[model samples]
Target chain A: DAMVIQNPRYQVTQFGKPVTLSCSQTLNHNVMYWYQQKSSQAPKLLFHYYDKDFNNEADTPDNFQSRRPNTSFCFLDIRSPGLGDAAMYLCATSTRGQGGGETQYFGPGTRLLVL
Target chain B: DQQVKQNSPSLSVQEGRISILNCDYTNSMFDYFLWYKKYPAEGPTFLISISSIKDKNEDGRFTVFLNKSAKHLSLHIVPSQPGDSAVYFCAAMTGGSQGNLIFGKGTKLSVKP
Candidate 1:
């Protein structure tokens, strides 16, 4: 079954400390996305990669960064964790075809807790 | 600045009745819409979708209606079952190669048996 997978379903990090949440996919999709979702809010796009070409949202903070080392793996690195950043991090993937109406498949999501 | 909005936070319906979830969007460039169902501790699963070219799209017991003029779209479920209870999210897509999606906050639906 081809699906997206995220590591450390629950993560705890100290304030100002660096934390990395990882995502991988067996779907071999051309596009991979990272979204931040707070309680009672919609998931916000942080960044995404299209076959290694990184596209960051204009409103995304500088503290957030991402790297797609290969086709199947992508990593989200928080330069310094903040209490306000505590939320669920979701990873999703989609193919490039279908004329921009592609369906995105999501992982279970990594719930981050900044102490 | 929410591009997509699901005004209702929650809704309840009796089993075997109809369930309607509505969503509105401010972006006119959005030409595609999708509805996703999510359970607690699980990722959202795609349920149904509609395109700007089409007014409605149906699948199984689920149907999606898109009204381009009003910038409103809705998901309709017939003969709702308890198993259908979950969070329903409405998402819209702009016409581009990226296929980035703007999503609503989501509406929690409870189907009582």
Candidate 2:
């Protein structure tokens, strides 16, 4: 089945350590997104790639960065992990084809824990 | 600032009854609205959506109503089932630079059998 996959469902990193989360999609969607979700809160858009063009949220901190090497893969890198950075990181994909309003398909999030 | 707001943190309803979830938005520029259902340990799945051009859109048992004037949208589930119990999030989108969605705090619905 074509779906989005996130590596390392649960990740633990020490404070100030750098960590990377990976996402891949089999759906071949042209758009991929990364979101940060705290417990019981809405998913905050971190950044996204529209066919290799990186678009970062204006409020997103500089510590968070993303890279999309190809259509199927995207990575989120945290320059320095902090206790406040612990949250669920979600990956989603969508294609803006004809009849536009495309719904995003999300992958099981990567839960990050910063010690 | 929170653009979308789901006032109810949780709601419980008997099976086969009607479940109504409400959402409000402060942003008048939101032209597209969507609802997503999420289960524990899983990502949210799209449930239904309504465009600003229309007041209502229905699919099977799910119906979404949008009031562009009031900046309010709602999801109604008729004959609710246990499988419908999950966290429901309301998201709004507007055309801009990135075209990213703004989501509200989710509402947890519990449908008892």
Candidate 3:
């Protein structure tokens, strides 16, 4: 019911292997975001898409990239997954309408375990 | 550097008591602050928020207080219940940014009934 969804609740990839995580939202919001969360740490912004306009965090590594092929789908691609990259990936969506900036709705994150 | 910081890693509260969660930030540029509650294996849900211009905001049993000078904010829950036990994260939004929130590590609250 109009919520964000992430595929493969859990993922496993070996060192140096490329991995892709997908996110989609039924909320039909114009803005979508990707965040990486390590255990017991804050969720860090990796990048975001505002209707296909990509905004990457200044501190985010180049190895991480995102593509929003369409309104409902956004993908996070890790060129070479490392053991250090193991963490939960979260997706969120929001719309900046009349009232201006609103709260973001997050999806149950995908826990990635790199082998 | 962590823009938002929840110094208290964990807290315990007695049932039906007031739960006060504190958050501090190093960035004076942050103009918006939010509180999110999360359960294990689940995503965080927005609880409440306060803008830098306002000193306080309230909803139902929850309230948020923002002190712009100190770069500190607080969330208060009255008559806390056991179900309130969960991880609470404090986040901040920089000026001119859309919905980008810099989050704190989180504080785990245990409400004992």
Candidate 4:
């Protein structure tokens, strides 16, 4: 079953501690994305890798960073976790075919809690 | 600022009836749109989509209508089934290549059988 997979469905991190949330895809997609969703709000794009190129949203906090070491995997690193950073982190993948090919497929999402 | 807006926080529909969900966007640059369904503790699943080039798109019992002039779009489910009940999200795509999506706050729908 080719699908996006996220590890540690439920994650707990202490405040000011660095934590990493990871994502991988069996879909072998050309693009991978990271989105942050809070309670009852729209999921906001944190950043994405268009193949090997990483594009970050303007308002994304400096505490957050990502590394797509290769095509199959990507990691979201929170250098200094804050209480407000606790939320569901989602990973999505898509192909880069004709017409932008931005229609994304999502994973189960990682719910992070700050202690 | 949120480009796409779903004003209704939730909706209740009787089974075998019609369910209509609405979405509005402020960005005129958005030419592509999509609707996604989600259940609790799960990620959103793509449901239906409509492009600005077309007025509507339909698949099975799901129909999505686009009004480019009004910058509004709506999803219609006829003879709605309980299985169709879930959180519906509307997303707007701006630019073409390397374009990112702007999503609206979702509306949770419950279908009573």
For model 3 chain B, the run of ten residues with the poorest summed lDDT: B93-102
Please give, for residues A9-71, the per-residue lDDT of candidate 3 as tens digits: 999999999999999999999999999999999999888988878999898999999999999
TM-score of each: 0.97, 0.97, 0.96, 0.97
lDDT comparison, 1 vs 4, better candidate: 1
True contacts kept of each: 0.63, 0.61, 0.67, 0.57
List, residue by residue over B11-110, the lDDT tens digit for candidate 4.
Answer: 9999999999999999888888999999989988988888888999999999999999999999999989999889999998954747587899999999
Taking the tens digit of each residue's C-alpha lDDT, what string does model 2 give over A1-115? 9999999899999999999999999999999999999998999999999997888888999999999999999999999988999999999998865543568899999999999
Candidate 2 docking class: medium
For model 3, residues B1-113, the per-residue Cα lDDT tens digits are: 88899999999999999999999999888888889999999888889988788999999999999999898999999989999999999999854786788899999999999
lDDT tens readout by residue for model 1, B6-113: 999999999999999999999999988899998987778889888899999999999999999999999999989999999999999986937778999999999999
- At residue A33, candidate 4 shows an lDDT of 95
Of the candidates numbered 2 and 4, which has the greater DockQ value? 4
Scored against the native two-chain complex, candidate 3 gets a DockQ of 0.63
Considering only the true interface residues, what is the Cα RMSD of candidate 2 after superposition? 1.9
- Runs in model 2 deviating more than 4 A are A97-100
Give the lDDT of residue A7 in candidate 4: 89
The lDDT of model 4 is 0.92
Query: Which has the higher lDDT value, candidate number 2 or candidate number 4?
Result: 2
Docking class of 4: medium
